[model samples]
Target: MKILVVDDDPGIRELVRITLQDAGYAVAAAAEAIGALSMLEAENPDLAIVDVMMPGMDGFALTRELKSFKDMPVLLLTAKGALEDKERGFRAGSDDYVVKPFEPKELLFRVEAILRRYGKEEEAPILAGPLEIDRQSYEVTCGSRTLLLPLKEFELLTILASRPNVVFERERLLELVWGLDYEGDGGTLSVHIKRIRGRLEGLTDRVSIVTVRGVGYKMEILP
Candidate 1:
């Protein structure tokens, strides 16, 4: 897991870096909100530790902005321990609150708890347009209709729908859907695609698997 520590104070920032790193996580530290946003553009952190009462944008404001784009958790660290302060943090989309001069062990526990909550959600069904795939239940649904596809066909569909509109080449899809060790010609891929299309036919007009001719296929969601 990766964590981004945002604090104006070098001491607090470095402390968080050391603590999380020792706990077996990758760490990135930034001075303030602007620098944190810049870091986000380059790399994505699994969680962010933000400090309240910064110079320009406070932790509450930063947490709000980050949550607007990402679905990850934000933890607030501050000197204030009043109930109102905690409420404000929650209002700003903070998943947890840690007071200043926090016990390192407690911080670690809270971080783990927050991550555990989201981990379950990550495995749940993924939805795009009218298509939905639930890995846990091994179910695929299009609109009100449920699809019953063979193992390979279902895997192929899930692979494409996971990243809708992103064109995947034949070699890449084969490598991902069928293991590299599998000895199968590319014609097998075409056959599976046809079967998947047949299952999707008339289920929903909003989604379709589009062939890229010489390339491979992509699950396209129509507006």
Candidate 2:
């Protein structure tokens, strides 16, 4: 998974970046909130580690803004560990808070916990417009029609439909669906997407997989 680290302090940014990178997560860092917001689309990070104290926009404001922009989880890191400050952070849509002068292991633990919670939440059936994706049964149902897909196609559709309108990068999709060791070109992904698209075309018009040009693909839920 990819993580975005936002902090004004260069030292803290590097420290967090190294910590996450060492744990096998792709890391991106920005010195301020604005730059972090700008990186949202291109980075498509699964989680964001945001420092609460900054020059222009504080972590609280940034957390709210980030939630409005994407569905990813946010962890607020700050020196303030008081009740009111933590309440404020939580009120601003932060999934978790980590006080400064923290142990790297503790930070990593909290990150894993939050991610686990999110994964559990997504374990339920996903309803995207007219499509219903059941991860358990590996079934895709569109209205009254039940569409069966190959293993790769089903996994790809499950990922896209689970997060409607979220742009999933091609490499990320490959890793999630085809496994990290899969030695395949982008053409394989394209072929599978084409097949899924063909299946959806015959089933429903409200849901579609949109090719995002240089990016990858996203499930678009049309009205």
TM per candidate: 0.54, 0.54
Candidate 1 local lDDT, 1-223, one digit each (tens)? 7888999999988777865754446898898998998899677888999999898999999999889868669999998999999999999999999998776656876887898888822455778787788765778887677877788887788778777888878986776566546588999999999888888775877788999989989988888
**What are the runs in model 2 whose C-alpha is more than 4 Å off?**
120-223
Error of 1 at 187 (Å): 69
Per-residue lDDT over 1-223 for candidate 2, one digit per residue giving the tens place of the 0 to 100 score = 8889999999999878766654446898999999999999999988889999999999999999988886679999999899999999999999999998876667876887888888822356778898888866888897788977888898789778767888888987876666556697999999999999899999988888999999999989988
Tell how far residue 181 is off in model 2, in angstroms: 38
Rate residue 127 of model 1 by lDDT: 84
- How big is the positional error of residue 31 in model 1, measured in Å on the Cα after superposition? 1.0
* Residue pairs clashing, model 2: none
